[model samples]
Target chain A: MSFQISSQPIDLAVLRNALAHPHAGACATFEGWVRNHNDGRPVLSLEYEAYAGLAEKEGARILAEACAKFDLVAALAVHRTGHLQLGDLAVWVGVTAAHRDGAFGACRYIIDEAKARLPVWKKEHYADGVSAWLNCAIRGGFSTAAGPPSGPPTG
Target chain B: MKTVRIQYFALLREQRGVGQETLATAAATAGELYAELRSRHGFTLPADRLRVAINGEFAPWDASLTDGVELVFIPPVAGG
Candidate 1:
């Protein structure tokens, strides 16, 4: 089990290969990308900043909690900090287990817990020459009971 | 008396106007020490929204404090 908080974008191929195993029947993966828009405004980019040491520690705790809750064989979570442009991979989570349910459940739980508990913030820059700092409490509006990364809004 | 090392991040750091501090107090619990620090620094943090971590593990506000422990106050952030 490995949990990392990094400034570089996550390499999906590397993560996929690392989680592949002979005994594992299922491998579940989650990728978070920087979107171009939020609330109908064209977003230029986002700046992610973190309290590096504490964030990594909280991430490790979340990983441990998920592993205990689910029957996962292995789990890895990586989140990107610093400046991120649109279409860049912001986060990645991969879980492997003997069964599909465990892999899927652990993957979802890890992402949700990280968002709710981790200490990383994003500053959204819009095309209209406006930017705003969004914190965890306010961003909870974007999260649902199922989890975050809910996709774009409907017209 | 024990010394607790405090670290702040994100909005909390900006709001407190300081990143870190060390306090020597006779308070027995994390909450108690926080109360003393808040009073001394005059920082206005909402009790419910803030999360506290002791020695890299999340702890409740009322958790006990230990000598030379690191306490982090996280004010929440967006995670992708």
Candidate 2:
């Protein structure tokens, strides 16, 4: 029942311990890290910003949904905000359940749902003067370096 | 009358120039209230690309509004 959206870095050990319980026979964790390159350019850094209150609320909702839909015993999700360097952990999600299938399914659901629904946004800082908005296509099965969106421009 | 708490995030926050606000309106649906806010704030957002959460649950724009409900607007972004 832990949900947090903070500017501070996430503590993985704490998350792992929280998911360790007798009732849970399996635990699944997902960590999202900042990459060094995007769109064939060297990324300087990334700044993640979010409406903290809303983000937390959304995380809780997603957690609740997972619990309701799966046989999960416990769940924790945390997303980092503010400036982050390359290879920094951007998001962490851990789920524990009575069986392997439930743990894996719930963990995947949480990560995909968070990316699709969370209010957090990333600003990619590159070596060149150019920067672009990051469109999180979790289910779109495409790479981030696919160039600028070929569709009509968005406001 | 109902008062809805509205929260903006990321680029939308920058565009709106504020993070949160409470609107006291007689609007029946979230979509109506969003239209009012867009006109007042003079900000353009791709409503189809964005998602809305009412009281911590993902909801459609046509969802009915209630007093003291927290309305959150989320823009699409990447994460692992």
A1-155, model 2: which lDDT tens digit per residue? 86788788898888898778899999988888887776567887888887667678878989999999997999999988888887888888999999989999999999888876667788777788665557633234344433433321111
lDDT of 1 by residue, A1-155 (tens): 77888988688888888888888998888888888887677888988777777778778888888889987778888988888888888888889989989888998899888877678877788898977656433433342212343332110
Which DockQ values do the candidates obtain, in the order shown?
0.42, 0.35
The clash count for each model shown is 0, 1
For model 2, how does the per-residue alpha-carbon lDDT over B1-80 read when each residue is reduced to its tens digit?
A: 89989888766677789888887988788778777777887655646566888886678999999899998777675544
TM-score of each: 0.76, 0.72
Give per-residue lDDT, candidate 2, residue A11.
87
lDDT of 1 by residue, B1-80 (tens): 99889887765676678888887889898778767766876555545556788887778988888899998876645776
Point out the worst 10-residue segment of candidate 2 chain A by lDDT: A146-155
TM-score of decoy 1 = 0.76
As a TM-score, model 2 comes out at 0.72
For candidate 2, give the lDDT of residue A54. Answer: 66
Off by over 4 Å in 1: A68-70, A128-130, A136-155, B1-3, B23-29, B32-44, B64-67
TM-score of chain B of each: 0.83, 0.87
